[model samples]
Target: MAPLENLASGRGAFAPSSGEPASPSDGSGQSVGSGSSGRKRVPLGNSSAGGGSTSGNPAGDVGLGGSSGQPGNPDDPFILPQENASTLDKKLKVEVPMEIVVSCGPNGVVLHPGGYRISPGALKGKGAILAKELRSIVRLRQQVDPMIRPRPSIEFLVEPGGFDTYHEARRQTVISGLDWPVSLQVADTKVLDFFPGGRF
Candidate 1:
C-alpha cells in the first residue's frame, strides 16, 4: 500500500482498503478537489517520476519554457509575448513601389494626372478604362501624357463620405484590374494637401 502522505498529496496511485484494488476514493463518496472521479488533484508544477502526470508536459507550463526562460504567472491572461524586431521589420517592409493611384469622392471616381472622371452610374462599365489609362501613363506610352517621366510611386486616396455602399466593391474592382503595385488610403483635405500639387 502507498504511504498515507503520498495518497493525500496525490503523489501515488489510490491505495485499496481491502485486498482488491481500492476504488478512487474512501467510502465517503466525495472526490478530491470536487472532482466527480475519486482522484486527488495534482499541483500544476510537479511531474511524476516516470514522466506521467494528470496535467500535460511540464515544459509548456506558464513561464518555464516560454520564449524567455522566466516563469510566467498563470493568473495573468493578458500577457503578450515579446516578438523579434528583425522579424517584424521583414514582415512589414514594402517589396514593390506603388504604381496605381485612385481617388474616389462624391463627385465621381477621378483618375489622377489627367483628372479623368467616371460618374457613379458609369463606374460599373467604364471602371476598366481607369486601370488601362493608369497603365499607359505609368509606362509613359501615352502621346499627350503629362507625366513624361515615369515614376514608380503610386498612391490611391479615397475621400471621406464618398461612395457609401459601393465604395469597397469599386475599390476592389480597381485593385484587381491593375497589374502593378497599388496603395489605398482614406484621406481628408489635410492629408491631400501633402501631395505634390495639393491634389490627391
Candidate 2:
C-alpha cells in the first residue's frame, strides 16, 4: 500500500487497485472499471417527450446534455415576463386622492368643525343637504341684520366685485356699468342649508 499521504498527494501515485498494472489510461477517463477505456457521448435529449427541451417544460428546455448554450443565455433560456410598476400598479389597482376644493354653496357647510347634515335623510336623497346651515342660523339669531341683508339670508352677498366688509355689502348694490337704477324683481332669497359632521 502506498503511504496514504503519497497516495493523496499524487506524489508517485499508486494505481487504485492492487496487482493490476497501469493501462494506457489510469481508468479515470470514462467508465470506472479495469475493462472500459473510452467515453461515448449520447444525445438522448429527445427521449423524455419531444418537447422536453423545447416543449414548454421549463427545466428540460435548458442545455440538458450540453446540446444548447448556457442555461441563462437569452437565446436558449426562457425568462418569466414581468410587468413594471405602472403596469403592476394598474394590475393591483389602488385609488389615491388628488386634490380638494372648498365651496360655500351646497357643499361649503361641511368644512367647519361640528358641521351637521341638514336632514337626516339628505345623504339618502330623502331631504335637503342645507338643513344644517338652517339649524345653525336658528341656533344663533342675534347676528342677523335685516336692513340691507335679506331676512334669513342663506348667504350674505359680497357685492359682486368683491367687498371686504358687511357694511360694504350693505352699501354696494350697483348692478354693472350701463345699468340703470331700474328696480330688479328678485325671488325671495331662502336657501336650504346642510353641513356635514354635526349631528341632526
Candidate 3:
C-alpha cells in the first residue's frame, strides 16, 4: 500500500481517531505545548522494552529491520487489491468472429449475406437489370469461389469510454462498402446484430 492509498483509506499520518490530534514531540528532547493541555505525547518511535503501548509503524517510517514500512490500520476502509495478470486473463472474454456480405443486388446494396430477410425495411431502391445480374454473380462466388476467404471480423472492447467510437466504426463498416462484420462479445456472451440498418 502507498501513502496516497493510506490517505484515501483514512490511515496515514494525518488521520486521527475520533477527530483528536496525535500528540507530537519537539526537537529539543521535550514535550510540545500539548503537554500543558494534559495530552499525552505519543512516542514517534517504539519505546524500550515494557515502556508503553504501541501504535504500530507509521507510513514511510523505517522499521526495526531498517526498511520503510506502511502502517496498517484496521479501522481504515478496505481496498480491494488489484488483480494479477493471470487472474485478469481468466476473467477476460473471448472475441467472436462474424461475416459481413456486401453486394449491389436487385434489392439495392446488401450489407448481409443472409439477404433481405435479415433487414427487410433496409432493402430499398428499384435496382436495374445489371444490379440483379450482379447479385447472381455475387451469390455464385459466395457459394463456389474457394479463393474468396472470409474477411477478418472487427473487434470492439466494450468498455464504458469506448462505446461511441465502436458504434461509429460499426456504422461505417456496413455502409462504406467495407466487407467485414463487427465482433463484439461480453462476458462470454455473443451480442446479436443490432446495427443492420445502421439506425441503432
| Candidate RMSDs in order | 19.6, 18.7, 24.8
Steric clash pairs (candidate 1): 16-22, 63-72
Q: What C-alpha lDDT, on a 0 to 100 scale, does residue 170 get in candidate 3?
A: 44
Q: Which of 1 and 2 is the better model by lDDT?
A: 1
In model 2, state the lDDT of residue 33.
34
Which numbered prediction scores highest in lDDT against the true structure? 1
> By TM-score, who's the top model here?
1
Better of 1 and 3 by TM-score: 1
What candidate 3 gets wrong by more than 4 Å, as runs, is: 1-91, 107-200
Each candidate: what lDDT? 0.54, 0.33, 0.40
lDDT for position 182 in model 2: 19
After the best TM-score superposition of candidate 1, give how far the Cα of residue 157 lies from its true spot, in angstroms. 0.9
Instruction: Give the Cα-based TM-score of candidate 1 against the true structure.
Output: 0.33
TM-score for candidate 2, residues paired by index: 0.20
Tens-digit per-residue lDDT, 19-63, candidate 3? 654333343434344566456666665653433324433322333
Comparison by lDDT, 1 against 3, better one: 1
Against the true structure, what is each candidate's TM-score? 0.33, 0.20, 0.20
Q: What does the lDDT read for residue 171 in candidate 3?
A: 52
